[model samples]
Target: MLSKQLTTCLAVGVGILGLGFARSNVAVAQEKVTLVERFDAANPYRVELKVRLSGRLAVAFEKGKPPEVLPFSGSSTLVYDEKVLPADEPRTAKAIRVYRETEFARTIDGKEQKADIRPAVRRMVVLRSERGKKVPFSPDGPLTWSEIDLIRTDLFSLALVTGLLPAKPVSPGDKWNASPNAVGDLTDFDPIEEGGLVVEFLSVVTLNNKKYAKLQISGTVKGVTDDGPSRQQLSGTAYFDLEANRLTYLNLKGVHELLGPDGKTTGRVDGTFVMTRGPASRGDGLTPTDLQGIALSPTPENSLLLYDNPDFGVKFLHPRRWRVGTVQGKQLTIEESGGGGILLTAESNSTLPTPEQYLTESRAYLAKQKWTVNGSDQPRRISDTPDRVDRFAIDAEVDKQHVQMEYAVVAQAVGGATIAARLPWAEREELRKDVDRIIKSLQIIKRIEK
Candidate 1:
């Protein structure tokens, strides 16, 4: 009886192994699809999109119900090889596929209505191409759900699509298509194509724990208004998802010139594009967690010490009724009664040189500005009982002022360090005394243990 049972168990184990092998073979046989293939094969289309413009224009039923402002709503169309579908063909053969949807809230006749509209299929033929070559694919088709979602979520569709393309590193002088309409004279404009957009890949980066290829594209286009022309630039990252077999993320950012009524370039309008694959797992779309909190301004008594990330740290103090303003790249500005100003900045050094060595290098750099150093001395140590302190007299011949400054520079074993305060020459002595006190009061606070 024991031998029979053992034989049965062995048979079951062997059957399970055989089934696993068959499944693995089937998975291997499935052909791998690239991003381009998936996009091209997907049906392409377009829609006669018309949104109701409140505060202007008349109310009409043809305007249709307003679309819901759902997260990830927009419109998009896939591009197919021209060889398969020529533009000169009949409407049936030349028809292109498109995916589109719109969700919005609208008030009609004092009644608020919410609507979601999607195109079953729409066809359009390519009327014109920027390049005077044989027209490739027609711009006509039914809209897809993905395309409409993107259009609604992204402020601009063309800009978002251009950003989604591959941007692997490429040498200079390489020609690349930067827009759907790629044949106009684009010179001075923004990141998106003004008339004709061409981009060249520059580098690659791994961000948000994902790898991305970067590119730099430039061209000229019409200014923000229907006035003149301006140059535009596009630079950012793009990548493909191996698992989804689609273009996953495209992050493009840049600026373009705004034009005036005289047909001349004016100021500029900056823009950004971020495109990603739709949600995969359950409860994975945009959620409340996606929204970021607004940054609160620092109070008068408590100044914001540091805001830069990666090495962020801050310190604040009672202003004692001092005027505050920004200076250069640093914050925490103060004006003293003695006709002097204090500028607090974070200075980063590659190496933590000794106090004397740091001052020697710093003074040399400062001397280039022709500011004379009248005298020097050592002051009392502050915070952590620093090992060294240096005081110097800066005489401004041009501005005609006598300034005394003190540096409570501390040394750390690490290679890099930062200095927090920079004071003006005229009121150095008085500000120096307060700075010394502030530094001495520095105490490293530790979070209470759980």
Candidate 2:
């Protein structure tokens, strides 16, 4: 009887071991599913992007003194409706995007300043490529500095999302190279100078009642940006929805360091971005009827960006090549990438100056700044309607560089604006049309008390 009981216990142990091996094989089979990126042009998606960053800026009060570090924090939230448009090449396809809401704020010295966005530029528009970068513009008008800045960098487009996936089936613990284009776009780095991201399939997990293929990515790359050379190190996870066949969620945190000419770090930005993409819900904007009649092609006028500054009682339209710069006192400066710029100053003098008087005063001011006026044109009245507009041109030499300067004054009943634009003499004719568009579109508005 004792020998028979021992045999039964051995048999039961063997049966339990066999069942455990069978279940392990089933789990391994479940992990080996193929992941492919599929997009449907008929479907429209709503994307919510949020970013928050806090870092210290190095400031040198004295030339030889050690730099002072100032703490600053900034956050931005943007919700937009996007529809993928058909393309000859799926990788470079453009999309129509309508921004429903955008909010940006910066905190410094214990004070927060929120961006003031106008409502007009928020309308429906097509995104056009400028030097391999996507820029959103509308037929209605140009976008302001705040609007353009928000969309300029760190925007993860459809092409980028599709590029992040593997070309073949990946199992748990499998690793592959995330596309270089995807990494560049994700980090706002164009033409990645060196290094790339390696993605490792972590596991399949359930989040919010949906299955997701969790992925881990880490790398460091050095690249060039519009601001200059930048180095960034990224560590993040991406959630690719298995059933939906889409990269629905991504959360990336990284340190972005700006390098100077000597390749030394001038500043560093540590930030995190969390983005989610999915089908649009009702009332998220981008209904079929709302998208009808929207122009997908960009015209020269529609591609231009608008600068609307109601506080200073002035607004104007400029080309994409020009970027708005620092504001000192009542003067605002806009600069073009090709060494051309405009300086505008507003004054509250009720007594408006005539074209001749304005020209004489401007030349005198330029002379005081050591500018040698080689030639000067007579002032002319360009418009005499709601506001009187007068303009004159000057050929001058300053700091051993020959430049062409255009001076204009828009006079109104309450106050007036003085405009000064400078560009390299050789490129004046090449940039003539763009400069004229800016000057012609200038308008004075009633000053809004903030």
Question: How accurate locally, in lDDT, is each candidate?
Answer: 0.36, 0.72
Worst 10 residues of 2 by lDDT: 1-10
lDDT of 2: 0.72
Instruction: List, residue by residue over 181-227, the lDDT tens digit for candidate 1.
Output: 22221222223333555665433333333322333555444433122
Structure candidate 2, residue pairs in collision = 142-306
**Cα-based lDDT at residue 67, candidate 2:** 69
Maximum-TM-score candidate: 2
Give TM-scores for every candidate, taking all chains together and pairing residue i with residue i. Answer: 0.27, 0.77
Which lDDT value does model 1 have at 12? 26
